[model samples]
Target: MAGPTAAPTRREPTPDEFVAMQQSPEFQELRSTFRGFTFPVMIVAFIWYVVYVLLATFLPETMARPFLGLNVGLWLGLAQFLTTFLITWIYVRWANANIEPRAAHIRQEMEG
Candidate 1:
C-alpha cells in the first residue's frame, strides 16, 4: 500500500508580480479612467462646497438676500444636495460606459 500524498501548495504573488498586474493595459485603463472622472468631479465638488461655506460665513448678508422667492442661503444650501446627486449620477453613467467593460475583460482574463 502507498502512503497518502501531500496536498499541493498555493503560492502568493510577489511584489513584482503585483506591479506587473497593475501595469497591465486593462488594469491601467481602468485605473486611469476611474481617476480621470473622479478627480476632477471631486475637486470641483469640494471647491464648490467650500465656496458656499465661505460665502455663507463671511458674507451672511448676501446669503440672506432673496432670489427666486428663496433666500440666497436656501438656494445655495439646496444646491449642495443637488450637486451630490448629480455627481453620483454622472459617475454611474461614466462607470457603465468606461469602467465596467474593461473590468469585465480583466475578470474574464483572470478566469481563463
Candidate 2:
C-alpha cells in the first residue's frame, strides 16, 4: 500500500539569479513589449481626460450644448465610462494573446 506523497517544494531564486533573469533577453523583451503598449495608452488616456476636464471647466457653454436629448457634457461623461470599459477589455485581450505566453515561458524557464 502507498502512503500520501509530499508535495514538491519550489526553490526561491537567489539575488544574483534574479538579477540575471532581469537582464536576460526574454525578460527584457517582455518588459519592452509591455511598456510599448502601456506607455502610449497611458499618455493618450491622460490627454483625453485632460481635454475633457479643460472643456468642462473653461467652456461650460460648449459642454452645455444639447444633443439628442442630452447635453454634450453628459455624453462626454458617459464616454469616459465607456472608454474605461473598452480599455480594460482591450488590455485583457492583448495580455492574453501577446503577454501571457511569453510570461509563462519565462516562468517555466526560471522554475526549471
Candidate 3:
C-alpha cells in the first residue's frame, strides 16, 4: 500500500528572474503589441464619449432631433452600448489571434 502523495511544490521566480523575463524580447514584443492596440482604442473611445457628452450638453437641439420616434441623443446613447459590445468582440478576436498565443508560450516557458 502506498502512503499519501505529497503535493508538488511550486518554485517562485526571483525578482532577478522576473526582471530578466520583463527584459526578454518576447515579453517586450507582447507589451508593445498590447499597448499598441489598447492605447489607440482607449484614446478613440474617450474621444467618442467626450464628443457624445459635449453634443448632448451643448447641442441639445441637435440631439433632440427625432428619427423613428427616438431622439438623436437616445440613438447616440444606445450606440455607446453597441460600441462597448463591438469593442469587446474586437478585443476578444484580436487577443485570441495576437496576444493569447504569445502569452501562453511565455507562461509555458516560465513554468518550465
Lowest summed lDDT window (length 10), candidate 1: 103-112
| Reference-based lDDT, residue 69, model 3 | 91
How do the residues 19-102 of candidate 1 rate in per-residue lDDT, one tens digit apiece? 787899869878988998899999999999999999999999999999999999999999999999999998899899999988
Residues 29-102, model 3: lDDT tens digits: 99999999999998999999999999999999999999779999999999999998899999999999999999
C-alpha lDDT (0 to 100) for residue 20 of candidate 1: 80
Instruction: Give the clashing residue pairs of candidate 2, or none.
Output: none
lDDT score for residue 89 of model 2? 96
What TM-score does candidate 2 get on C-alpha atoms? 0.90
Candidate 1 accuracy as lDDT: 0.88
- Residue 50 lDDT, candidate 1, scale 0-100: 97
TM-scores of the models, in the order given: 0.79, 0.90, 0.89
**Residue 43's C-alpha lDDT in candidate 2?**
92
Count of backbone collisions within predicted model 1? 0
lDDT of each: 0.88, 0.92, 0.93
